[model samples]
Target: MRLAPDRRTLLLGLGAAGLAPRVLAQPRFVVPPLAPLRMEVDRITKITVCVRPFRAAGPRLDVERVAGKRVVHNYGHGGSGWSLSWGSAQIAAGKALEGGVKEVAVIGCGAIGLTTALTLLRAGAKVTIYAKDRAPYTRSARATGTWSPDSRVADAAKVDAAFPALYEQMARTSYAAFQTLLGLPGEPVAWTDRYTLFDGPDPGVTFPQRPTTVPDIRFFGVPLRNLAPHWNDLEPSQHPFPVARARHGTSMQFNVAELAHLLTSDFLLEGGRIETRTFNTPADLGRLKERVVVNCTGYGARALWRDETVIPVRGQITWLAPQPEVRYGLYYRHVNVLPRPDGIVVQYGGDSEMWGYGSEDETPDLAEAEASIRTIAPLFEAPKA
Candidate 1:
């Protein structure tokens, strides 16, 4: 979408003052040549649902003694489990190691769990992951897999004054961890150009302003536009979409299929053990024999630990055949189209930013998938001159 007037002015002022010479010297935006998508309904290979374990006050990273066991809670990352897995896991593993435990049990085998287990292993702890499902089968696999460290991460009113700074630290730490995976075999993680498209100019929508007394929720008080290395405003003709304006940026997109396999493989090769089991209650953790446990159960913590605060934000995605020629992603209206190695993920983010809160339904709605596809199908049509 078109940049807000104030944002445009700020960016222009920076360029005019020669403060951002490298950015100002770059060529004006143009849509990268991409193959037109095959949007037929029959091309859909799978439809998956993910219930994000959203906590209003942000992810619960505290430690608690449960049944005489030191349980380091690491879940409730909301929509950022994959995005901030490593950093959050690092925190959890550190807590587990506080007791000088040589062995640890990691609950859940999702992205967060695996990362926690790996981090513990790296720290010389013998780790075992106990879970009902591993990656590719876990809810983490259903994610659209984009790097959005602060997407609905927490509620403004619920978070404490220190939450934003903590979030920034996690974001930066996770970003650095993911960078190490680049160019590795299977291309588990790679950068992709992303565009946020709008049908017209700015909608003039503004968030209900919060009082200054509260900590600023704007990701370390820095606008997201400025966070991306390549944030640019594109004219109508510069973007492939029929939308009148677009905000383009580069993001790290995860190939979850490859990533899961790679992580699991590495863990096994590194002497980490994974057990296929599910814990029905918190007491079940005591049977593991590990004195310390890191709970990366993700949404499962709701029932396992009876954590009512871990509300589920339901998300569904329709996967179409992969388009190797299409390397970028786009967000238009409420729909997001992300091209991954497995397939092109078409997801509905809903109307308002707070859409799908506390939704637990996991059934895939074909009608909803079709509706979302219809919204972006026109982008494949010949653009107007």
Candidate 2:
């Protein structure tokens, strides 16, 4: 005979008895005001190109002994250099400090290099960055500057089993680091609304009815779609887009110019030094007086160390005159429209995410820019109901 049901047992019995059906409240979404995009092609101010250092095996963060000095590799972030800069720098700086070195040398002055130098300085180490080019002039400045931590970060097949968890850690670390810069004088980093538009049911959208075993060798350790916090699905009537579906989320968009200035200033103020010099080979690193060297050379790492795995993923952006009225970003028809403090950036996402792989062509195509503008201009032409 069973004893009288306890509260816990009674709840289990009630659930098994189907006494009540679980009901969840449907979320009420608010529709934002429709703002027409300013897409005048004639107002285009500038065009810039950047090459992302994509490594199929993911970023190289291992330590090596070179010329009797400790060399910490911290490059090869692919499209995520801007997104993962701080976190990756932290890892590199920690490794550099493993032996408790008092001084550190950072090669390259892009996002990764500057952050690494700053990180070392914060940790009570004398830091110096040696590079041919600096921020605002480096490839990092040309980035679209969105918080996309896993965008082509690695090829799943090439990464190890532990990479996803590690990637998550770095992504979270970088996110937290960027938060400290928000609302500062230059507004280096700020939250902005991003809308992913769909003409119909987006072919890119996938709904897994059941969990399928994903192979370990994938570009992302975890899918980027699952990482963003303020992501929401909206009905056509609940969004400002003319499209059938719009995925809305809030992301930290960096004003590259202001961010570079801020990072450079912060690094200098913290006693970090910058040396404008170029290195042709890994052997050149030995010339530096510091016993520990952190390599943040980005794509230059491909040639400096002769690493064949580094691939160039070229990206171009067309800037239109500043449009203060435009506060949101939109990705539609493989075109990205991002409004920032400096200018409005319009870029092509290409047929696939890896469309420009291995291409170093920096030349900006005006015809291509015009075509991208035409594709999304119609959305603004439609009258808001």
Candidate 3:
């Protein structure tokens, strides 16, 4: 799924994709009149969903001791896997380079694997991606493709004081890298304006409060510490809904399908190669021509590497007709509505947030799909007239 381009992408030389008749003809947005705040249940006829189930019966990761046989474990990122792929890959490869290996094998072909291959290629290391599946078909393609790092990475404080700096650096680097890709002929990546509405008391948190000149680090909604007035104001007539506050940010959005191909093409263009093979055991890492390996297996790490820390937090999304007029993304409570070129991706995080708490495997639940739509209906409700 691809997010529509916002203002930043244009300035950064990252152009938007072909606009639909409505979007291209009138690129401006006149805030729609607020209808009565009434939530209408979408008439869901046919349903499709992506289900992720978890089993506690796995090995916990000694994250510090993650690497093996010159292999740096880069999997187990869970939901944030796609959002943080390139950043994490850069970090993993940075560590892998310490081994001084000029060649590397990337162990999964999802977003993590593909990005790692590109990162390695840029580092002048020959890379071979070994995976069972390809893009669009891969699990990474199933994501809604928003750039927020929340819920995906481990707690910043727990990881280390320095870990936040590392995470922030990777994010900035990947942001720059993606911008470069967006400037290419295809416009494979871009940014979208995401609106996260809140109705209740303030979460008492601000974002982008501390300003950094870093390209990827920008203020979202309001300054992180500003409490005096507010960032955006809503008039009685233009209010979209009866919301206490709203925070909006320019977020990184990409067409996962295009991005997958872009990464692969970039690698091949740089003389990196890909091979198809499955590793049933860790021993396969030793057999590869590359001495260093970066694991991008995603959820597959559970069985292949017998990783216990890896847990599946199932997420499902509903694809709806493109509403190009809806210029912002919405996250209200657990339900989120993300607009993409193909359709709107809606999802709700259920018991799956329990982490190592569920017994269900990677099963698709259409009912859960319907339920997720119901959960976020309020955010899509029209404002009162």
Candidate 4:
């Protein structure tokens, strides 16, 4: 029953032809190469410092009656103040409006205070923000702003059993809230591709660890990690970094200058008043006519409330004048560079979570700033032709 040699050859050729179409039917996807960053050292602009109000047991979101004033505490978000603001604001403002207080006062104008005030105003309550400093002048402005919901959010060992669920809720809510701000004027909030460059042969294991000098004590809430915007491992040719490996993810960044303006404008447009006033003690809050107040003093909470629980984690940013062509952010050798609409922020987190975990120093270091530029400069070297 065997076919003759010529007939058998013809039958094999037909089978090969059939396989060709199936192979060709499959599509190939290529990762587009990214634009090279302009990492020149001379591009440096300004440097600033901020103290994140880290607390072991997470943010203080409790209520107390002080001097006949119902105080809704909403401070100590650590590095996550900006990221978790809206969600936590919803909680804080809800407590503030519990008794149906028509006139409410917010004591602090950082991300938390402003958002809480806006949330209160939207809840149809007359809100006034009485703070010593507004957005730009506050320590919140000096932050290395990023959507870091759990960046030193809490020491897991120190948080309560219920805290993780609460943290996840806040992170999820804030993620949804930021989405509505996309495509707005000024590009107040937007997504940027972030590349993490590694120099080792095996870039090793899952979730892709970035090397750090200090122990990473920061709490990582793994529940909402699926909500991570984007993640893709890139072949060496797909990226311009001169590294052994590169991993990419989409990180949400806030153009603080624009974001602050938008939040401030929105509050006022909705009939919320912002007064330049400072509170030195709990008694000062009683002087105001509003019976309900939400305390969002951030690191200042340490002094005003005499609450020793609030720990300060210092963070500094070295800004370079913005380059319109640069649209991406990157991490290399533990230093981070993000090109924002306002400025190109360069921060050295080589020490990782503990870099400034307990520091409160607000002094600007020019040498340390220059060192960051040096660390990132090598990656942007003109690629060989």
Give all candidates' CA lDDT scores: 0.81, 0.82, 0.58, 0.81
- Tens digit of lDDT per residue, candidate 1, span 124-207? 999999999997789998888888787767877778988877887777778889999999977899998888877732323222
The true-versus-predicted C-alpha distance at residue 313 of model 4, in Å, is 0.8
lDDT of 4: 0.81
The residue-by-residue lDDT of candidate 3 on 40-143, one tens digit each, is 23644333333232222211122232224666777766555565667778778887777577887888888878888888888888788898887767878777
Error of 1 at 373 (Å): 0.9
Models 1 onward score TM values of 0.86, 0.86, 0.70, 0.87
Model 1 deviation from native, Cα RMSD in Å: 7.2
- Give the Cα error of residue 267 in candidate 1, in Å: 0.8
- Which lDDT tens digits does candidate 4 get at residues 1-385? 1222344455556667783222222222233555666666577788898888988899999999998899999999988999999999999998999976899999999999988999899999999999999979987777776888988788887888888888888888888888888889889898987888788322221222233333556565555767766677877646656678889888898888888889999999989999999888898888999999999999999999999888887777889888877788888777898888878899877455766766777888777777777777766663522
Of candidate 1, the 10-residue stretch with the lowest lDDT total is 205-214
Worst 10 residues of 2 by lDDT: 205-214
The C-alpha stretches of model 1 lying farther than 4 A from their native spots are 1-25, 200-227
lDDT of 3 at 22: 24
Q: Using TM-score as the measure, which candidate wins?
A: 4
Q: Which runs of model 4 end up more than 4 angstroms from their true locations? A: 1-33, 200-220, 382-385
Our tally of clashes for model 3 stands at 12
Clashing pairs in 4: none
